[model samples]
Target: MKRFLWILFLGVTFSSTAQRMVLKKGRVLDSIPVAHNATDNFGLYLPKNYDASQKWPVVFVCDMKGDGLNVLENYKTSAEKQGYIFISINNLTDTLSISKNVLIANRIIVGASAIFSINPSRVYVAGFEEGARFASILPVFIGNVDGVISCGSDIGSIEILDAKNPFHYIGIVGKGDFNYTNMLQTENVLNKLKFPNQLLTFEGGHDWPPAKKLEEALEIFSLSSMVKGNNPKDKSFIEASYNASWERINSLIYSLKMLEAEDLITQTESVYPRLVGLDSLKEKLRQLKKNKIYKTQKRDENAAFNKESLTRVDYAYYLEEDVNTYNFKNLGWWSYQMDELKKHSASPNAIESQMGERLMGFLNALIQENIGTLKKEDPIDEEGLRFLWMLKTITAPKEYSNYLKVISSSAKNDDFGTALFYTEELLKKGYTNKSELYDLKDTALLRITPEFNELVAQYLKGARYELPIE
Candidate 1:
């Protein structure tokens, strides 16, 4: 079966000579046509030193929005530094089913291999956010995916993981990201399944880790390749990486990030066991574990994690109840919850603050998922949808679209009172596009209402319609 899949992936052919003629090294080339599919294309980046004489490791990047060139640019520097060929699929999107996207990814992979001298043993995949979630699952459908560098996300589904077909999984996430807790939990599961995995965290939110962090991931991949005998070992490279790991460990300790320091120590021990001794790392970890500050920080973090877990359950339960019941009356209660989250965010305890932020992000994502699913229902539950959209205005105040949806949907139902309320609320949140307000969908009559115009005049100081003084 694997052989057949391999044949299927490699069957598509491109004129290698012609591709090589136009392709430039050390630059991101956009819109390279897929061999079998004319509509599908991908972005590519070859290291400056790339040559067909030797097989090079490749990282297939998945961008959920299909903006391949832009996503490729984000990873180009790390790929260039690590001598890995980087390619991004231009047609993969979250809107498409996972099966369809995986197929699209397979075609791009086939085209890339046909055009470049790719190292089959060292082939990997990477992505950020939704893209990361997609990349995490690709190895299941595709053959020979050696590793996955998932940024800001965890595995697509733990149930799909197989112990026999293990792939090196490297997750890079921010401490404040909603997925941070999920990644940590996933690491525990991966460890039990005996999958070679590492979770790297930074002090930030749910976005791409810095370029240096990506370089570190590539370095880990390189070190793993050496350990597996897939690449020739370089003593200098191993020592340099070892020294850098120690430096990072110490720096993390100095910054009072005992958790990160411990994680790095564990990762260093795992990657360097073959090339280096374990005595120093073991002793350092023992000492760090005994430190009073480390103990306190670990305790606090555990407490916060427990609290966050319970909070997540409450949020999930309540959100489902509210959505199904069209509990518009509970909107005020949701507003109170948001205020409490704000208070937690401002707490002096860093862990608590981060937990608050994660909770906020989690609730927003939950609401968004509910809204998306609700929109796809056969007989669209307009009331339920409106309630979720109204709730979204509370959960994600800066997201103006939800407010607009509330206005449009409410107006469609002839509830101008709700429409006028959201209009003023949207304006209060700094929405200044008068034209968009006037042109809102299903608000043809509502937009011209005296109430809507008065609210708009009050907030924006200008209304399209001038009301007569009665």
Candidate 2:
């Protein structure tokens, strides 16, 4: 691995004075301390065409790592294109109580509105992954929020969705993402409840969709406003939006993306009645619904779900037993199960492949929820943590922190060989934190050894520490 310099900047606090927020247009204000607390900082972005005299929609975003700037970057382009104010707190974590983060979000909302012309009727929340779940639940508690734009995840709790006060929901998920099924289920529930919603599917997994996808989500909100007469509906704007959506639906059908095509057709069917180009859209939708490919795909989807349920039940039982007994011997069994899932994901049968992706996603969610519960024990469950870290290493190899945890646990138990092995693995994953490599907890003995130093030198070239460098 090549040496990479990582710079971490501290959030700049703004005093709560009488002056309005002095902000530049079109650039992310990396951090703005909410309530003058460093830990309460949020990223803010204003459209280049922003006008203080006119009200604009404002979106509050969240990320699990409190990486406000990073999440905002994924959203700013779409926000700028749509002319919305955006803000996100960099202090939320899944381990923290949701109420605590809600308070942080509320503070930013109130603070931003005080200084900007944020339209209360258009207040929305958006987030990715765990943050997406957090955003989904906010409209229930925060009455000011009008809707939610959830990416890569679904609602934290469907119980919180109030039918009487239904808010708009725009779910953007990837077909290969673990939460794809969750989003699909959410769409049905939302539709059944008469909630205005749309589920947009792309082509990848467990990651943010492209900027254009984000723009489509914002467009949903914009279109909704026009329908409700909150914003004046210009005929041209409505036609352009309708034509754009029609083109996307047509493209999905032509590319054999039957599921995505069906979703878009359903969406436009429900929505086009109120917009321009309804006749043409209805004809296109009619043809799509009658297509042989569409019928076959829907049947296959149902079959896949039934098969996946059986497989999930079997795996769930063994995984629960393994966790209950701390069965290290079953680690190989778990590994095999994971491999099977990967294989199915690559299968030629499209339905089987989708089911595989959903199952993998389900497993990851199960382990994560278990880990969250286990961590809240009075005295932390080290053994449980170790088990989860090991599971995460296999299930989510891209997550380097779990590997670090395993290395730490091994070092604490004086398992130098295991610790060194993970260190090498972590470095192989392209981790560049040389400082933390030596400073890893309970690794004093292992960090000084030639084997560890040699491994470090292989990655971080000039590192030839005969003795502990520190």
**Against the hidden reference, what TM-scores do the models get?**
0.93, 0.83
For lDDT, the strongest prediction is 1
Regions more than 4 Å wrong, model 1: 1-21
Judged by whole-model lDDT over C-alpha atoms, candidate 2 comes out at 0.81
- Against the correct fold, how does model 2 do in TM-score? 0.83
Kindly list the per-residue Cα lDDT of model 1 for residues 196-260, writing each as its tens digit. Answer: 99888887888889888888999999999999999999999999999989999999899998988
Alpha-carbon lDDT of model 1: 0.88
Q: Show the lowest summed lDDT stretch of 10 residues, model 1.
A: 1-10
For model 1 the local lDDT of residue 178 reads 92
RMSD of each: 4.9, 6.6
lDDT of each candidate versus the true structure: 0.88, 0.81
Positional deviation of 412 in candidate 1, in angstroms? Answer: 1.5
